[model samples]
Target: MATPDPSITTWEGIGHGGGLYEQGYIGMAHGWSTGIVSLMSNYVLGVVPTTPGLETWILRWAKGRVGTPQGAIEVHWTLGEDAMSVHLTVPAGTKVNVQVPVKKGQFVLLNGEQIEALIEEGYVNIGDVKSGVYTADVRQRGSVACKPG
Candidate 1:
């Protein structure tokens, strides 16, 4: 039964087994368990596999560290008014794609160098980025011409 304050109650809702009110106090908070695991893996750890067997993957570029068979991958980013500064460390032999949020026609930069491609579908699609530490930053169009690389 819910108390008037609700916060003062000893139990929350019915038990996992469904409405056995007499002995309904199940121990674990199920919702929080899922949040701590699933949410942590996707957003914080930023580990979303795009291909099977980890041959290639997508890095969402949020924060935190994750370990793969090659080694450890760590990413940290700082958001600014018009750009984001990302410091990334990828395991050797890994090839991953990086997605940065942006509007179409906007430009993207890695280590202060402009990328030739424009943003598509609300993101700048940077693909097949090799393993290594990098300083990535984004710049808008008209700031600098994209150099042929």
Candidate 2:
């Protein structure tokens, strides 16, 4: 079966009622809100954890969609003097992709080392990755000033 376009579908709410025999009534429906939230987190944010305790991570900018039209997810926090890190988990055997904001002359570091990346439209694209927990650190011109905080 084909999935309906959520943008134009009318979300129907399940209802419950009772007569002289039943003593329960239905509450207002809120499925629409739930579906929207799922779409954003699963498709837009694309940060899915597979392991029960978040032992594996998957970083996909936008999956099953053309673009992030809703804007990218941003997190800002300080780390001991000059350290910043992000964490995520994904299921095993699943291909993962990550989108990192980048500029010319900058590179991506997987584990304190530089790796070949595709630079496009002010973003660094990493693809063909498998399921696993990952921590990435970005540096510009050999400087750590641009690290996430």
Candidate 3:
């Protein structure tokens, strides 16, 4: 059942239904979950994987949209049982680029470590690669740093 007000998009979930509407009803507040995950991964945690199977990756945090008075965000994650935990953080007005699973002799650092690149498939590629969250800030105007060997 819905209210008479057309502007009121909120509604109660009905236990009986099928397909998309049924799924939506089953998880009436699913958007909140997705939104929180998106905020943490894209804006707060800032973890973006590049290449298939996360062969490469990048991290960039946004302090403005975090809705907190603080000017930085901390991120922590684990890789495997043998690998050590990885932790990173970024403050307001700071820029950083990280690439994972990099191969030797494939990338070149230019402009006093402000730029990172490599020739992939005969193409000169830059930073902010793709896989999970897309970071336009790095691609637009930000320094690039390759993964340490």
TM values, all candidates: 0.52, 0.39, 0.21
Per-residue alpha-carbon lDDT of candidate 1 for residues 82-128, written as tens digits (9 for 90 to 100): 55667788899998798777764456777667766666778777777
lDDT of 3 at 89: 52
Off by over 4 Å in 3: 1-25, 28-32, 51-55, 60-149
Query: Which candidate comes out best when scored by lDDT?
Result: 1
Shift in Å, residue 7, candidate 1: 16
Better of 1 and 2 by lDDT: 1
- Sort by lDDT, top down from the best: 1, 2, 3
- lDDT, candidate 2, at 110: 58
For model 3, residues 1-149, the per-residue Cα lDDT tens digits are 13356763434343344223555545543444345554566655567767666578775432333323435444444343222222345455554464432233333332223244554554334443322222211211332443333
Least well predicted 10-residue stretch by lDDT in candidate 3: 131-140
Candidate 2, residue 106: Cα displacement in angstroms equals 2.1
When sorted by TM-score, best at the front, the candidate numbers are: 1, 2, 3
lDDT to native, each model: 0.66, 0.50, 0.40
